[model samples]
Target: MFDNLVADFERPCALDIKLCRYYHGQCEDEHKRKKLEQKSNNSTSLSLGFRICGMQVYHPETGKLEKYNKYFGMSINDNQAVEVLRTFFGNSSNTNLHNISNTVRNIHTAILNQTDFVFLSISLFFFYDCKKTDVTPSIQKTDIDDQNVQAGFKVRLIDFEKAIASSDNKIHQLPQRIKDNINYGMVNLANIIDSFVIEK
Candidate 1:
């Protein structure tokens, strides 16, 4: 029973970004691990610490919704990740930028505070309203809302089936490599978002 995150938006643009450079778990079968590694290496996940798993954005100019599949995500290189994010956030207005920046900052803070769990194969899901009226030409930095769903933009971390918690007695301690991978992903994502906001 999961709640619809984008139910409130009229025209919601959604993006699924898979975090961490590694996707395989230590306990997985050797064959499956290799397959996951190959998939990660073939996508932006290997080089960028993140990959666009999927996206659906409403293009106002075309009055049509554009859907990007996992194949499109896997084909893109590190150099193209920024442009892909730009498309997701939309270049026509600053509203999305403001909201996304705030969301990223919140995610960063949450990541910093998280110490007992190591998330594996998780994704950051971003959604924002794409209606023309939702676009705001200018917004003061001070007016940027701190809430996750401010201005109809929101981001949430999902896909936690592989997450390892320190409280699990079977796993006496979480491995450092797992922790490092998540930190690496978050840091790289923050840098990417920072660059995108700065460029806009």
Candidate 2:
């Protein structure tokens, strides 16, 4: 019953990135904690603070939509994350790096403004039009009024079932891991997006 986010786009491409270094939040079971830890360590979530969970990309050349499962995401290393983003952003002449940069900046700013909140097992959902004709060149001349949806692309934070609000005194009092915070993930994500934008 949920609304389709990419309904407007002729060819939509989407990427789901799990955020934060730690996925489990204060699990009482020791075995479960170790399992979650191992899962995070094996994926880019431990090293990069974020891991690609899944993706659906439309390849114009092949004229088909390609699907990538969690296994493909788990196989990617820190260095390959940038290339993955590049593929998501596309390399068409109509691709706008500034739009991507602005999108990252907006997400970073939103993260910065959110204080005293611990987000666990959450994800970032990125979607855009894969068709070159639907890609807008830049933010300046876009007919769409929403700046967040520039270039027919949008990024949103999703999956809050495991999120811990500041009101949770227990979590606030607990010792925080180095990269367990949402800010850590956002910073790493911004850096990765910047790297891709600069290289382009």
Candidate 3:
């Protein structure tokens, strides 16, 4: 239920809700049409020259080869056959290929976006220190600024190691949001430290 909510929110606005609902399995016939939509999204936007399910017709974008009666009404011939095999064989999935890929892409994009907050935090910290120091520090061990910089660095590093080890499912079964927030925060923090770190 939570995944459904987040997945809905994750989609960029302006995309048709009806279309999204249709794809996300909100309707009664969703299961039946799942394969068709999977084919559509995975391949790319369809053109007028394209054919619908169970019909042997050429798609303008995909040039050559008519879609046969299968996953997307397409045989997936030649090199495409290899790709199709890989997609299905590698996953042991019952869901259509498009849905599978969509889920993965969504997770990936979410994790990446979550990390952006980390960079923002680091950049803000850098500017704060720069204002006091009146200049940027060099990123080296010999160069140091302010008091106990090394202690701060060490504490931050320990915190980092703890965070990563804790976030893993093995050590701690963390919620996705928590994992995302931590990872994003850590990445940005690392970036900021790298910008003007010194080993004084």
Candidate 4:
């Protein structure tokens, strides 16, 4: 199951861990609780982009098939990739409607802690588009900060916002922009980052 999710994208590791923790009752954040509901209702393209890539998706209506969006990594058609998404979704549990509305805000807490999903997503893109550019340069600085996160050095995050932005931009290809908005909902995003000073 874990392998399938990882094969679906770049790093389902974080998602696996988050979902695991949630299943075991570990994560508890009101903010995250709110967003998980949103995540569940988010667009197929957004979800698919984070889950797979390198392909075009279409929204099929009663008699029409329209190109929805395009991605550049992994695929819904690959055996391994298909397995991952299936495994992840297959394991999703049922929740109490009352708890979801009163005790908790959404169905799953893991989807809201998005850093893992974003990181793993970068990996999938590389898996499919390794030749686009060297990904190391984009990640090196942040990696150093990740190490210093425990050292009291505030870390700033830039890559995350850009990732979400790029994802949103990719969905504009739909002819009905409002329909796209309905699928994605509102786009107010927060960047989970801190400023860090290196004492070199």
Task: State the displacement of the C-alpha of residue 166, model 2, in Å, after optimal TM-score superposition.
Answer: 1.3
TM-scores of all predicted structures: 0.80, 0.80, 0.17, 0.20
Task: Provide the clash count, candidate 2.
Answer: 0
Tens digits of per-residue lDDT for model 4, 83-176: 4433322211122111111111111122244333222121111111211222221212343223221111112221222123426653344344
List model 2 lDDT by residue over 71-182, tens digit each: 8888888777767777776654423555665665665576556776656656778777777465555454322223444566666667756666767866756556732555
Candidate ordering by TM-score (highest first): 2, 1, 4, 3
Report the Cα lDDT for residue 72, model 2. 89
Clashes of each: 0, 0, 6, 12
What overall lDDT, based on C-alpha atoms, would model 3 receive against the true structure? 0.26
Per-residue CA lDDT of model 3 for 130-154, tens digit only, reads 1121222222343121112211110
Clashes of 1: 0
Q: Which residue pairs does candidate 2 place in steric collision?
A: none
lDDT of 1 by residue, 26-112 (tens): 645888788877888788787888888899999877869888888888888887777887777654344556556656666666756
Which residue pairs does candidate 1 place in steric collision? none
